[model samples]
Target: MKERKGLIIGSVIMIAIFVLMFIKGEPSKSIMVWIAAILTLSIYSFLYKDNVFYKFAEHLFVGVSVGYSVSVVWQNAFIRRVFDPLFITRTYIVNDKFSLYLFLGIVIPTLLGLLMLSIFTKKQAWLIRIPIAFVVGSYAGMGIAPSFQANIFEQTRSTLYVTLSISASIMIVGVISTLVYFFFSKEHKGLLGKTANLGIWFIMIAFGASFGYTVMARISLLIGRMQFLLHDWLGVIK
Candidate 1:
């Protein structure tokens, strides 16, 4: 009972805050930027810990977003693309007086909608098997069919390098040396072992680069939020 009450109170508070913001309208032209800034910071606080306020804010954000999406999808896609055309072109297309084959475009997709009924019953699911087969076949043909050349073409390309060029030879040697490093049965004493050491260094450098990029991305979001609070919320110019 306490949990339920807590949930309700949290939800109501979030909804009320959002509703008040909506009703208040934008605070000047700059308020949009400021509100965005604060909300972003508040939301990022979730990465640290879970709490009632975070859950409340998150649910509110999702609910409002979904509501907005529902409104937009119906208004933009269904209405503009499907509804309006059906209304305007219904007579012309349905009566077969048009040259555009519009009826088939609408009718074919609508007929395919029968496949959705397969979701309810196992027997009807077989009826959808044909469309599924077609989709799967086409996708395999386009995407994974070339994977047959994976070993031959890709491997051969890696080996086919400019041995005469200093930089190219160095890169190729480095790669080969790195490859030899992973054969852990051998002792680290000779050229092969030293090459493996260089490979490890390269791997570490690459990993560090990737790590730095990820940190920069998170920091960028944080910086953007901070900037928004000052320039947007407080009306302080950057």
Candidate 2:
């Protein structure tokens, strides 16, 4: 009885929203507006309580997203990168000698990729490690130098290259103090203890700023949804 009453209330609310949308919204955009409104409300249903409507909306979103991603990968990656290079395109047209290099490039990667599928077979499962190792090693080899340059070298250089201005001086001090706070080689006593205490203040300030930024981002999303509900669905605002 409780579930039926809740359903009845939900249906009434949806009907009222639909009527308002149809009355106020543009005729040309009515169908799309209705769809967006319904989906939005369906997702929002979770705020009240977990229900069949919310589950349906959640599943629908996942299904559509996966289907779209697959289509994109098929068109953009598989067909263009793999199929065309390996089979459809003719490298010999440009230079007969270069054909072997092009063929090997495609064959090597394709075999490596296919080796990943060996995991499905019990006997051939060990073969999957070869591809996995190759992928991991290649990624690590390519990423390490750039990651180190960006994170370590660049950050250290920037910290040391501080200007004589008040803001820059404060930043330098804050950074040094923060580093000292994390340094546990010696006991944080006397001057080092005071600096470490100052570092805690800086860390708290950074955390508060980050939390404020996150809240603003969430509020921005809420504003966007409100704009859609008003301007697009009900035409209450331009």
The TM-scores of all predictions, comma-separated, are: 0.55, 0.83
Residue 196, model 2: lDDT of 95
lDDT of 2 by residue, 1-238 (tens): 9998999898799779767776876533678777878888888889768999889989999999999999998889778878887667854335555667767777788789889989999999999999999999999999999999999999999988877899989999899899989989999999999999999999999999999999999999989987888778777667
* Candidate 1: segments with Cα more than 4 A from true spot: 1-38, 64-81, 90-102, 113-132, 144-167, 170-204
Error of 1 at 179 (Å): 7.7
Task: Give candidates' CA RMSD values in order.
Answer: 9.5, 4.1
After superposition, the stretches of candidate 2 with alpha carbons farther than 4 Å from their true spots are 1-28, 96-98
Our tally of clashes for model 2 stands at 0
TM-score, candidate 2, is: 0.83
| Candidate 2 collision pairs | none
Candidate 1 residues 1-238, lDDT tens each? Answer: 9988997898789657655654554433665665565567467657646766578678878999999999998798666656666776473364456735775665555456556557679767777876677668878998684775785677658667456788778667666766777778878778867888888887777799999999999899778775555445544444
